[model samples]
Target: MIETIVLDIGETITRDDRYWASWADWLSVPRHTLSALVGAVVARGLDNAEALRLMRPGIDVAAEYRAREAAGRGEYLDDSDLHEDVRPALAALRAAGARVVIAGNQTVRAGELLRGLGLPADLVVTSGEWGVAKPHPEFFQRVLEVAQAPARATVYVGDHPANDVFPARAAGLRVAHLRRGPWGHLWAGDPEVVAAADWCIDSLMELRTIVGG
Candidate 1:
């Protein structure tokens, strides 16, 4: 049975709607336009940030983010940003004696915001805090440390295949490919994704059965 369940932040535990909407407003573009670009980039198997560069060539995304912060607008998250099933599913998992962790490729501020929410997690961390990001074995190693469990006993759950499925599986941890977000649904039926995933889940609640307490 899975003793530790480590989840990705975007799309797995949260909607990611606010994050993209913030960027769209900052770039002075309609939300749908930015959203479409993101889709196109991801379809090409490129990082989502490439969308911003496509919208404004030679754009310095990090600098733009800082500028947004200075202008009294920046990354933000709250209860409204969480998925409808997040709280209940996480709480239930903890009650079932699983070590629940929220780790992902997010900025340090995102980690702070997540921690402030007091989610039912053993640890809430971001790549910015550790200076390592997903698809990197080191990130999964950190996750194992937080989990305090063997890799085989840990299950990494996320919506992205490159960042979540292939890497985690290669790192020796079980992986659950969540078919909820754009990436999730887009690659849901991909032969590679389907084969790589230990389990393919559509809802967080399904995890209750997988962990089986």
Candidate 2:
């Protein structure tokens, strides 16, 4: 039985439409380059400090691009409300006696976003604070340790294929892919990630069935 559920914050729990565009603009790289950089860092087992040292220059360019885009549109990016079903789904999981937490790459600002949404997570793991990002083993390891959860007993639910599904699977946690909505397009075309999932669902509500909570 799954005793705990760990979620990724950005796209999984909260629905922010501008995230990708903002990120792409912020880092001055195409969306695919951000994906590739994440993969490269994880593949090389580079820690946050080192990865930043190598990628920050390029990332700065991206960030500036994003800033300019935001200014042009008179739009400032921020986290959106929790998915309609998130609170109810999480409450149900809690009622069923499972612990819930969030694991993602976030900064202090992001933590505030969770609080504003009223998400029922018992723990919050941020790569921004951890100095590492997902798809890296350490990111999951630290979160698991913080949650005091055994890998086999915990299930992680997220949106990204490499950052969310694959590494969580490698860490020995069962994975649920949140496969719909904006980010849904990212997964639909990727054969490797689609094939790797233990379970795939279009919404967080579907998790209740898989883990029997």
Q: What is the TM-score of each candidate against the true structure?
A: 0.98, 0.70
**Top TM-score hit:** 1
Winner by lDDT: 1
User: lDDT tens digits, residues 106-181, model 1?
Assistant: 9999999999999988899999999999999999889989999899889999999999999999989999999988
Encode model 2's per-residue lDDT on 35-131: one tens digit a residue. Answer: 5554465455453233334556654543654566567642332434467778888888887878888878766556655665556767765776788
Give Cα distance to truth, residue 21, candidate 2, Å: 6.8
lDDT score for residue 203 of model 1: 94
Query: Where in model 1 is the C-alpha error above 4 Å?
Result: none
lDDT (C-alpha) at residue 89 in model 2: 86
Report the error of model 1 at residue 44, Å: 0.8
